[model samples]
Target: MNFIKTPTLLKNKSLSLLITARVSSNFAYQMLTVAIGWQMYSLTHSAFYLGLIGLVQFLPMLVLSLFVGHISDRYDRRKIVSISQLVQGICIALLAFGNYNGWITKESFLIMVFFIALAHSFEGPPMQALLPNIVERKIFPKASALVSSASQFAVIVGPGFAGILYSFGASLIYSITAGLLILASVLIIQIHVNKEERKPDPVNLKSFFAGITFIKSRPIILGAISLDLFAVLFGGATALLPIYASSILKIGSFGLGVLRSAPAVGALLMSALLTRKPLKRNVGKIMFTAVVCFGLSTIIFAISKSVIVSFLALFVLGASDVISVVIRSTLVQLETPDNMRGRVSSVNMIFIGTSNQLGEFESGITASLLGTVPAALLGGVGTILVVLIWRKLFSSLFTVDSFEGSKN
Candidate 1:
C-alpha cells in the first residue's frame, strides 16, 4: 500500500509544541505508574492494595470532573495544564524525597498518588479541549494521530526506562519523573493560545452539568464513549501485569517493563500508520472490529505463559486500541463546538478515565477472589459481551461511514 504524504498539521508550531509537551508529560506519568506499581506490590504483596492505588487516583476525577470541566472552559486552558504539571512535578519530587530517605511508606505513597491525581483531574479537560484550537478541522484526524503517537512512544520508552532505573533504586526513577514533568510544564508554557475566542459562561449548577446533558442529547457520541467505557472496564488486563511478571511469567522487573512497553510499541506503530493514511470509510465498523480483536488479544495474553507470546498479544491489544482511540477522539472533537469542547472532553474523560482506573480496581478485586488468571480470562469474556450488547444498543455507531460527517 502506498503511504499518504505528510499533511500540513506538522507545520503548525503551536501543535508541534503541544505534541512535545504531551510526550514529555506522558513519559513521566508512565514511568511513575511503573514505579508505583512495583513499589506498591513490593510493599504490600496484596492485589487489593494494588487495586486501591487506582481507586485513590480516580476518586479525584469522579468528584471534581464537573468543576474541572467548567474551569477549563472559563479559564486559560494552557495555564491550567501548565500549572497542573507543575503541581504534579512537586508531588513526584516529594515522593522521590521520601523514597531517598527511606521514609516512604505505603500510606505516604498513596497520599502522593492522590495529589498527583488531583492535579491531573484539573489538567485533563483543558488539555484535550485545546487541540482543536491548535489545528484546523480538516486535519483533526492527522493531528490526533500525531499526538497519540507521541504519547504512545513515551509509553513504550517510559516503562522500559523505569525498569532499567529500578535496579538502581525507586528514588532514581521518581526523581527523573519529577524532572520530566517540570520540563513538560515548561514546554506547555511556550505555546501561544488565542484568547479572543474564549467566551465562558458563568458557573452555576446548570452550567456545571452541561457536559453530561450534551452527551445525553447526542446518541452517537454517547454510544461511542460508552462502548469504550464498558469494554475497557471489563477487558483491561493491565492492572494484573505485576502479578503476571512475578508469578505467572516469572519475569523480573526488566521483563515487566518489556511487557508494559509492548502494547505501546504496537500502539505507536499503528498511530504512525494512521497519520500516514487516516481512516475514512466504515469508521464505526472498524472501531467495533478492532475492539473485538482487543478482547481476543487480551484473552490470548491472559493464557500465555511464554514471554514472547504474551508480548505479541499485548502488541495486538495496543494496535486494536489505537484504531478505536483515533476514531473516538476524532468523533468527539469534531461533533462538539469549541466552547463546549472542554465540557464534552471532560465527560469523555470521566468515561474513559473511570474505565481505566475502575477497571484496575475490578481486576484487583477479581484477582483476589478468582485468582489472577481466571480474573483476566473473565475480563476478556466480559469485553466480548459488552461489544455484542453495544452493537445492538448503538446500531447507529456501526453504520457511521466517515469521521468528518459523523452526526451529533
Candidate 2:
C-alpha cells in the first residue's frame, strides 16, 4: 500500500499533526471511559448507575450542540478545539485526584461527569467541522479512513491498557489518562487551520431553526442520520458486555477489556484495508449490507456462551459498522456546504449522541429487567426492523454515488 501520496487538504505537516493530536487525545479519552466504568461499577454496584454515566455524559452534548456548532462557524475552530481539550485534560486530572484521595463520592463523580460532558459538548462540533479545512476535498475519504483507523486503534489500546492499569489501581490509570490528554492538547496547538471568511454571528432563533430545517429537508443526509441512529440504538450491545464478562463468559474485568476491544480490532483492520484501497463504489448498498451484518453479528453475540465466540461476533459487528460509518460520514461531508458543516454536524452529533448513550441506558435498564440475552436479542431485532423501515422510507438515498460524478 502506498502511504506517501500528498493528500488533498493542507500540506503533509498539518494533516500529520492533526492526526497525531486526535489519536493521542482519543486514546486518553477512551482509556478514561473504561476506567470510569469499572470504578463506577465498583462504587455503586448497579447497572442503572452505569447507564446513568452514559446519560449524564451525553446530556450536555445533546443540549448545547447547536450553540457549539454555531460558534464553530462564527470564530476560529482551532482555538475552540484547543480550549476544550485543555479543559478536558483538567477534568481528567481532577478525577485522578478524587480517586487518589477517596473523595470520589457518587455526587462528586456525577458533577465531574457533567463538567467533562460540557467540555465535549463544546469540543465535538468544532472538531468535526475542522476536518474539511484540514484536508482537501478530493482526499476526504482518505482522511476519514485515517481518522477512523486511529480511533479504532485507540479503542484497541485504551481499554486493554486501562484494564491492566486498573488492576494495579484506578488512580494510576486515571493519572496516565490525564497525562496523555495534556500531551494531546500540546500537539493540537501545533495544528494550522486553513482560514476562511467568517460567517455572521448566530444570534437569531430563526437561524437556529434554519439549521434544523435544512437537515430535515435533505433526505439523503436525514436518511443517513436516521440509519445510524436506529441501527446503533437497537443493535448496541456494549452495556451488556459487563454482564457477559462477569457471568456467562466467566471472565472478569480483564476479559471485559478484551471483549470490548474486539470491535475496535475489527474496525482497525477494515480501516487499514480502506486506507490502502478505499471503498468508493456502491456506497449505499454497502452501507445497508454492513448494517445487516452488524445486526446479525449482534444476534450471534447474544446467543454465544463462549468468550471466543462472543469476541468473533463483536469483531464482525465492529468491522461492518465501520463501513456504514465511513459511508455516512463521507456522504454528510461531501453534500454539506463548508459554511453549514458545523450546524449539520451538530445535528449529526445529536442523533448519534442520543442514540448511542441512550441506547446504552436502554440496554442497561432492559438488561436489568429482561435479562442480558433477551435485551441483546431484542435490540438486534429492532435494528433489523428499523433498516427495513428506513429502506422503504428513504428509498431515494439508496442510490447515493460518489460526489465526484453524481449530482444530488
- Per-residue CA lDDT of candidate 1, range 270-312, in tens? 9989988899999999999999999999999999999999999
lDDT of each: 0.89, 0.80
Name the best candidate (by TM-score): 1
Candidate 2 lDDT by residue in tens digits, 1-408: 245244443356777787778878878877777777777777877777877887888799888988888877777777788888888888878888888888998778978988988887777777788778777788888788878887788888888887777888888887887787777777777777776665664578866655587778888778888899989988868877776877788888888788879999999888877776787677777788899899999999999998889999999999998988888888888777777777778888988887788788888788778888999999999888888888899876677655454335
> Where does candidate 2 stray beyond 4 Å?
1-11, 405-407
lDDT at 159, model 1:
90
Q: Estimate the TM-score of every prediction.
A: 0.97, 0.95
| Collision count of model 2 | 3
Q: After superposing candidate 1, which stretches have Cα over 4 Å from the reference?
A: 1-4, 194-196
